[model samples]
Target: MSAAETTTAKVPPTRPSTAQGAGGGTGGAGKPAVRRRAGGGAALPWTLLAPCLLVLLLVLGYPLARLVALSFQKFGQPQLWGFQEPESVGFANFTKILGDGEFWAVVVRTIVFAGGAVILTMVLGMLTALLLQRVSGWVKTLINIALVASWGMPIIVATAIFKWLFDTDYGVLNWLLSRLPGVDMVGHNWFASGPQGLAVIMLLVVWGAVPFVVITLSAGLTQVPKELEEAARLDGAGSWGVFRYVTLPVLKPIIVMLTTLSVIWDMGVFPQVFVMRNGHPEAEFQLLTTYSYDKAFVVNDYGGGSAIALVTVVLLLGVVAVYMRQMLKIGEVE
Candidate 1:
C-alpha cells in the first residue's frame, strides 16, 4: 500500500454519536449510563422516604394494629392484666355500640359541632385573610405576627384561658357584658347547659383554628393574580362579584384543604372539651372522644370503647375520603 493509504488505514473509524444512545436510540455506549441515571433518580425518592415510612410503621402501625385487635377481642382489666385471656368477641362490641342510642347521639352531636366549628373557622379565616390583603404593610406585618402568636399558643393554655374567660361570676366576659346598658350579666354560668357550654368551646375552637386557616389562606391569596382581579374590576364586577368569580376560583383548593383540615380537627376535639369540663364532660357535652374514654377508662368496658373508637376512625376516614374525592374533582376541573 502507498503511504497515504497506510495513513488512512491507521486512523480509527468514526463511531455513531453517544447522544443517540443517551436518548435511547441506536448508540449502545451511552445506554448503560442512561439506565443507571434513571434507576438512581427513581430510587432516590424511596431511599429518602425510607426513614419516614419506617418511623410511621413503628410509631403508628403497631398501635393501629393493636387497636384493631383489641376492638375484636373482649379486652378489659382482666385481659389487660393477663388474669384472663382476651376472648374473641368478633363483631359483638361493634354491634353493641351501633345499637346503643347514646352512641348515636354522641355521633350526631360530634358531627354537628364539627360542622359548625369548621364553617365558622373557614369564614373567619377567609375574612381575616382578605383583611390582611387590604391592610397597609405595617398593619399586615402586625396581623401576621398576631396570627403566628395565636397559632403557636399551646392548646391546653388556650383552653384554660377560655375556661377562665367563661367563668360564672369573675369572668372578664361577664364583667364586660354587665357594663352594657340594661344588661344584667353579673353572673352567667356558660357551662350550665350543654349547648351553651359547647358553644363556648366551639368559640374557643374557632379562635384557635382561625389563625392557622388565616395564615394558610393568606399564603394562598398571594398566589392570586392581581391582573385577574383588575380585569374583573374593569369588567364591572363588584367586590363580591370579583371575589366570587376571580378570587374564589384561585382560592378553592386552599379553601377546600383548610375546610377539610378544620373538619378533622373539630371532630377530634378532646382537650378543649375535656379540660373545660374538668376531665368529666357531662352526658350532654359528651363527644365521641370523651365517650370512648368514658367507656374504656371510666366504665371499664374496654371492648366497647375500642369499638367506639374504631367506629370513629372509620367515620373520620369516610369524611377524609369524601374530601379526597372532592380534591380529585377539583384537580380535574383545574
Candidate 2:
C-alpha cells in the first residue's frame, strides 16, 4: 500500500465529544463527586428544632409523665421541705374508685348534665343564630355584642354571677318571682335542693356555651347555599320541610362538631357546680370534676382524686375516639 494510505489506516477514528462520553467523563477523568448538600440542608431544620423539642419535653412532657406516675401513688404526707414519697399502690386506687357507688353515681350525674347541657345549648344556639341571621342593623350588633361579652367573661366570674342570681334572699330572680301572681314561695333557696341547683347550673352552662354553638352554626349557615333553600321552598316545602331536607343536611357536620365540643366542655365543668352548690346539701348534684376536686383538695385524698382524674381522661378520650371514627365514616360517605 502507498505510504499515505498506510498512515491513514494507522490513524484511529475521531472520538465522540466530551459531553457524549459515558458517565460524562473521558477515560482519565474521575466520576463527578455526588453532591449530598440537599440532605444536609434538610437536616438543618431539625437541628434548629432541637431546642424547641427539648423545651417541650421539659415543659409539657415531664409534667404529664409526673401526673401519670403520681396517679399510681398514694398521697403521702408532707415532709420537712417537700412532699413525702407517695405510697406505691399499683392499681388499687383505680379499683377502689371504680367499685365505689358514689363514684358511679357522680359519673352518671356528669353524663346526664353533659348530655342535657349539650342538647339545650345546641337548640338555643341554633335558634339564636337563625334569629341573628334574619335581623339587621342595631339589633344584630347589640345581640352579637351581648353574646360575645357573655362568652368572653371568665368562668369564675360567670359562676359567681349565677350564684348571686339564684340566691334565695337577695337574688333578682326570686325577687322578680315574688311579684308574680300565685307564686308565694319566692324566697326558696334554689341551691338548697339538688334538682333546683342542677337546673340553675344547667341554665348557666347553656347560657355560656350557646354562644360558641351560635358562632359555629352561624358560620355554617352562611356557607349553606341559599339557592338550595329557595328551590326547596319552590317545591312546596314549608319552613320545617326546607330546614329538615335542605338546611339540616348542610349543617349536620357543624352541628355534630358543636355538640361534641359542648359535651366535652360541660363534662369537665367545675366552676359552676363548685361556686353554686359546692356539691352541697349532699352529693346529689356533685359532678365528676367537682368531686375530683373535693377529693384531692377538700378531703385531701390525692389517690382518689388521681383515680377520678384518670377516669375522666379515659372517658374524654373515648368520646374523642368515637367522634373521630364517626367523622371518618362521614368523610367516607361524602
Candidate 3:
C-alpha cells in the first residue's frame, strides 16, 4: 500500500445521503414544506365541519336577519296584502311593545310558566330515573313503554284530549272528582278561571317534557361509575348525599344540557297553550308566543309582533349563554 493512502482513514462518499434519509428524508429547506403539509392535515377535521356551519348560517342566519329587519319596519295589512312597501320605523316598534303594560304582563306570565315547567320536569325526571335504575324485568319495561307512549303523543293531539278531560259539563275528571268525598269539581268549568286553565296547561307541558328528561338522565346515570357510587355509600353517605355529591358532579354537563333544552322548549311553548285557549282567546290567557301571533296575524301588527319575538330570542340567548358558561366553568374545574 502507498504510505499516504495507508496513513488516512477511509470515508464513504454516500454518507451524507444516508444521513439525510435518517433525518426524516427532508433537507433543511424541505422542513418548511413538510410543516405546511402537517398544518393542512391538522385542519382537515375543521374543513369537514364547514358544511354544518354553512347550513346553519343559511337556515338560522337568514331567518334571524329577516326578523330583525321586519322588527324595524311596520309591515301591516298594506305591506302584507296590499302590495305596499313597509316603512322603517326604527325603535318605535320596540318602544311600543316595551311600553305596553299588557305586553309586560304576558312576558312575566310566559317566564313564570316556563320556569315552573322546567323545575317540575327536572325534579320528576330525576326521581323517575332513580326509581327506574332500581327496578327490573317487566316492571321496567312497562314503565318505559308508558313514558314512551306519552312522549310519542303529539302536543296538539294531547291538548285536544285534555280539553275534553277538563270540559265543564261531562268531563271524566269532573265526574271522578265530584264522586270523591267532600269534592265539588263537577261543573267547575276548569277553563273559566285564567289561573286555573294556565295551571292545567303547565301540567300538560310538564307531562310531555318529563320523558325526554328521563331518558337523558338515565343515559347519564349509566355513564356514572358504579365503583365510585359504592365507595361513597360505604363511606357512610346516604342515597341523597351520594347522588348529590358523586353522581351529580359527574352528570353536571348532561344536566346542564337537558335543562337548557327544556327551558328553551318551554319558553317557546305554543301548541299546548294555544289549544287550551282555543274557544276563549282572552288577553289574560296570552303567553308571549300566543300574544305575538295574536298581534301579527289577528291584529295585523307585524312590526309589534316581530319586536316581541326578538325580545324572546334575546331572553333565550341569555339563558343558553348562562348554561354555556356553567358548562365551561365545570370543565375547567374538572
Candidate 4:
C-alpha cells in the first residue's frame, strides 16, 4: 500500500458526528432524556399529593377500617374507648342483622323513602326549571336567589324548622290544614300516626332535595336546543308533547345523572330522618340512616350498627352500579 493510503486507513476516513457524541446519541436521544425528565416531573405531583393522600387515609380509611373491624366484634363505647375488650364473633353480627325481620323492614322502608324522595325531587326540579325558562330575567334572579337560600340552609336548621312547622299543636301546617275545606287537622298529632309521620319526613327530604335538582336541570335545560322545541311547537306539539318528545330526549342523560346523585344523597339522608325519628321511631318511617344511627348511638350496639351501615353501603353501591351501568351503556360517561 502507498504511504498516503496507509496513513488515511490508519486515521479515520469520517469523523464522528456531533449528534452521535460520547453519549452515542440516536435520533431519539433527546426523547429518552425528555421522557426521563418528564417521568421525574410527573412524580412531583404525586409527591406533593402524598400529604393529602395521607390525611385522606387518616380521615376516611381509618374510620372505614375501624367500622369493618367492629362489625366482626360485639362492641360498645367501652370497647370503642378501650375501656374493655370486645368479643369477636365473626359473621354473627351480619347474620343477626340479616336474619332480623325488623332490619329487612327498615331496608324496604329506606328503599321506598329514597324512591319517593327521588321522584318528587326530579318532578319538582323539572317543573321549577321549566318555570324559570318562562320568566323574565329579573324574576330569574329572584328565583335563583331563593333557590340558593334554600340550598344553603343548614341541615340542622332545616330539620328544626320542619319540626316547628309540623308541631301538631302549634304547627303552621296544621293551622292551614284546619282552615281548608273538608279537613279537620288543627290540633292533629302529626307525628303520632305512622303514615302522617312518614309524610312529614318525606316532605322535609323532598324540600331540601328539590333546589339542587332544580339548579342542575336548569343548566341542562339551557343546553337543550331552543330550535327543537320551537320546531316541535310549529308541528302542533303542545307543551307536554314538546317536553316529552324533544326536550326530554335531549335532557335524558342529564336527568339520569342528577337522579343518580339524588338517589345517592336521599338514600343516605341522616339528620332529617334522625330528627323525625325523635317524634316517631316506627318501622314506617325509619330509614337505614336513622336505623343505623339508633343502633349505634341509641342502643349502643356498635357491631350491629356497623353491620347495618355496611349493608346500607352495599345497597347504595348496588344502586349506583345499576345506574352507572345504564349511563355507561349509553356512553353518558367516559
Q: Top model by lDDT, which number?
A: 1
**Model 3 agreement with the true structure over 1-334: per-residue lDDT tens digits:** 8877765646545456754655565356567877899999999988999999999999999999998999999899999987899999999999998999999999899988899999999999999998999988698789888999999998888898888888899888999998889999878888777788888898899999999899889888999999999999999999898999999998889989999999999999988877788734688789999999888888999998899999999999999899989999988998
Give a tens-digit lDDT track for model 2, residues 1-334. Answer: 9999999999999998765664564553434323356667889999999999999999988766766776788784452126676678899888888899999999998999899998899889999898888987699889878888999999889988887887878888888888899886577888677777798899999999987788778888888898999999999999899889999988888877777788889999987777676544258888999888888777777777878987898899888887888788788889
Model 3 clash pairs are none
The per-model lDDT (C-alpha) reads: 0.91, 0.83, 0.89, 0.86
Error of 1 at 41 (Å): 1.7
Off by over 4 Å in 2: 1-60, 78-84, 278-282
How do all models score by TM-score? Answer: 0.91, 0.80, 0.89, 0.82
Q: After best superposition, candidate 3 residue 332: deviation in angstroms?
A: 0.4
| Tens digits of lDDT, candidate 1, 1-334 | 8999999999999876666545665766677777899999999999999999999999999988888998998988998798999999999999998999999999999999999999999989999889888889999998889988998999999998997898997899999999999998788898889999999999999999898999999999999999999998999999999999999999998888888888888889999999999999999999999999999999888888888988988988988998999899998997
lDDT computed for candidate 3: 0.89
Residue-level error in angstroms, candidate 4, position 116: 0.4
Instruction: State which candidate, 1 or 4, has the greater TM-score.
Output: 1
Model 3: CA > 4 A from native: 1-34
- Deviation in Å, model 1, residue 192 alpha carbon: 1.2
Query: Model 3: which ten-residue window has the lowest total lDDT?
Result: 18-27
Q: Which residue pairs come into collision in candidate 1? A: none
As a TM-score, model 4 comes out at 0.82
